[model samples]
Target: MTFSIVGRCPETGQLGIAISSSSIAVGARCPWARAGVGVVATQNVTLPALGPQVLDLLEHDQLEPAAAVERALNANGWSEYRQVTTIDAQGRTAFFTGKEALGVHHALAGEQCVAAGNMLASIEVTAAMVHAFENAAGLLADRLLAAMHAATDAGGEAGPVHSAALKIVGDHTWPIADLRVDWADEDPIGQLDTLWQAYRPQMQDYLTRALNPTLAPSYGVPGDE
Candidate 1:
């Protein structure tokens, strides 16, 4: 029902996440990230608490992503239907899909990321997402978007994508950019890509201003200025 990317921006040294789902308001349910801490995507039978708790544990010096995931799962009151992925500050990653998770499919972890998507037509979607995240060389946001695009190309959620979101935390906890269409006529992933491109410049300006407001104001088309 959902596809998401959770990762660290290699260039900006920022932690971020992006997600889309056929379900409404996927933003409210799918992605979570904390700069200088970690990222988590708790989907399928989602667990809301895993979002904050994983970052909490990582901030406490819990560097082993697998251990952090295990502890989080253990504490989850609803584990049977949950699917979770956690990436710590060190880029260590881990994932878990419960027995009762939709379609019963799970995923594996690699160097800096983990991925899981249930109710997918094939395992290739999840595999391709993780591969893109691991192999792509660029900013974390680009890499994360690539992972999501790969999954969409690989057949996506075995259904439609209705809602999408991107969350990045840096020196500031507030999202540099966040948008959720909630519903779209078609090609929601493509719509998300368009929104990302349209928003990137403004987001960059916001971050720059936050870091040092003395920098020149964002220059764009005369109308936008």
Candidate 2:
């Protein structure tokens, strides 16, 4: 009941994932990324732990995306019910769609990205996502958002998606952008886009505050006045 794209910005080495699902709070369980490591999207009977486990292998163990995915599945008894995709820092990609995955499932691996979907309106959903991500020009987040929009436009989940998420990590351990519409009555993707627009200008500010509060600008809060 989910579709997602994981991509890397070659210019900045940023990793990002955008996803939407028929389930609520999909963001909390599906996407994971570590700066300078990789990104993972685990869904369809998702083992949330698998997301971090894959990243650990990619980052600490120096495993490529495919090898990390292989090791991850080798360690799990429930691999047959899962759908996962990983994109490493070097843009190496790997994906698995279990036979037990619900409904129609498909995946696409591209230059610096991977897209996957289960319980989709059609297998073409993943393809559309990949195309949009590769062709779109702009910030990494915007390209990711475009891919999510394309997925929905090309027939996303088998049912209406109630939640959406966009996550990106740059050089820092913290995410440069993390936006989610945990449950929305309307279009979760659109809501996520709005959140990104609102957050983008402050993204560098927040990072600066974290790395050097002395040089950080005002908070624009009442106390700062």
Candidate 3:
């Protein structure tokens, strides 16, 4: 019971992913991304290895997103029960929804974007998410958030969405901005969008301080540097 969108920011060249699910702690289980690398969302039955497997394939110069997905699925015997999407550093994207996944499961893949979900209201939910990401402006995370919002508006997970997450990676291959809003009283997607916007300025300030140390704007200088 999940809907997820994974995409690369054409503006910032940053890789990002956003996910929401009817399940508990979806943030910890669904989205996986590495800066300057790629992104993977392993849902459905959920095999944790798919996350690193995409990185391994991409590291070996597996440029085609479809090929990398094939390699990952083949390596994992439980593929029939999994739904996965992988977007490489070059913005090549791929997705697969397993046969045994819940009813109404589907996958959509496109340049720099992939959207997938199971037990959703309709294929329209996942498709809307993809369309929103493809057409939306702003950073990868923002696009992803828009996708999530669209999916929720279309009826998400065929039930309530309890947990949500956003992940953006920087040059260091570590999550420069990782935020998760797990479980909301009602309208979790709206809450997720609000959280992202509210935190966006602080995130921008943090990265600004890190990158533009010479200026040292009002947000204070980067101590990590």
Candidate 4:
């Protein structure tokens, strides 16, 4: 029901996740990331809490991606229906697709990324995403969009996808870029891309405000104008 990419940008050392699903509000339900820690995408039958639990193991327990994923799965009784992918800061990665997953499910890893999908129209979609993310140019967000486009180009999920999300963690506890399309009948992924583009220019300003308001730029909204 979902396809996602969890990646560590080799150039920036940033971690993020780009995900889409046929289900509603996949943004709030699937992706999770921690600054200087790791990223997780938990889908398929979809246990939302598993995302944070995996990150907890990575951040607090100081476990690597594989160990953290294994521990999280072992602790849960519902592993058989979940497909979760995890990637740590060091480019270490691991994935699990339970026996109860949908149509065509698979996970593939790249130099600093992992792509996974369940109920996919084609198994090659995940591979295509990894290739796109690895070979694409520009910022981490752009590369994530490229990988998402690759998945759709290769025939994404078995059904029409309705929601999408992109979450990137930098130096703060909050995401540097958290963009989501909770649901869209037409094109959620495209909506996500557009939202990211609109936010890109203001991203730095917001971060500056968070770290040092005196140096941050003006709001440029109605009141400021």
> In model 1, how large is the Cα lDDT of residue 211?
82
lDDT of 2 by residue, 88-122 (tens): 88889999988899999998998799999999999
> What lDDT would each prediction earn against the true structure?
0.77, 0.92, 0.82, 0.92
Candidate 4 clashes: the total is 0
Between candidates 1 and 3, the one scoring higher on TM-score is 3
Per-residue CA lDDT of candidate 4, range 1-225, in tens? 899999888878889999999999999999999998999999999888888999899989999888888899989878999999999888899999999998899999887899999989999999999999999998888998899999999999989999999999987888999999998997899999999999999999889888997887877677653
Candidate 3, 1-225: lDDT as tens digits: 888888887667788889888777788877888777788999988887888887778877655777877888898887889999988788888888878998789888866788999998899987898889889888777888889888878877777778888888867656877888788767777777888888887876667667787754563446544
Question: What global local distance difference test value does model 4 have?
Answer: 0.92
Q: What lDDT does candidate 1 reach at residue 173?
A: 70
Off by over 4 Å in 3: 61-63, 208-225
The C-alpha stretches of model 1 lying farther than 4 A from their native spots are: 61-63, 211-225
Model 2 lDDT, residue 224, Cα: 62
**lDDT sort, best first:** 2, 4, 3, 1
Candidate 4: regions farther than 4 A off: 222-225
Per-candidate TM-scores read 0.87, 0.97, 0.88, 0.97
**What is the lDDT for 151 in model 2?**
91
| lDDT by residue for model 1 (176-218), tens | 7676667886877778778887887687777777789788485
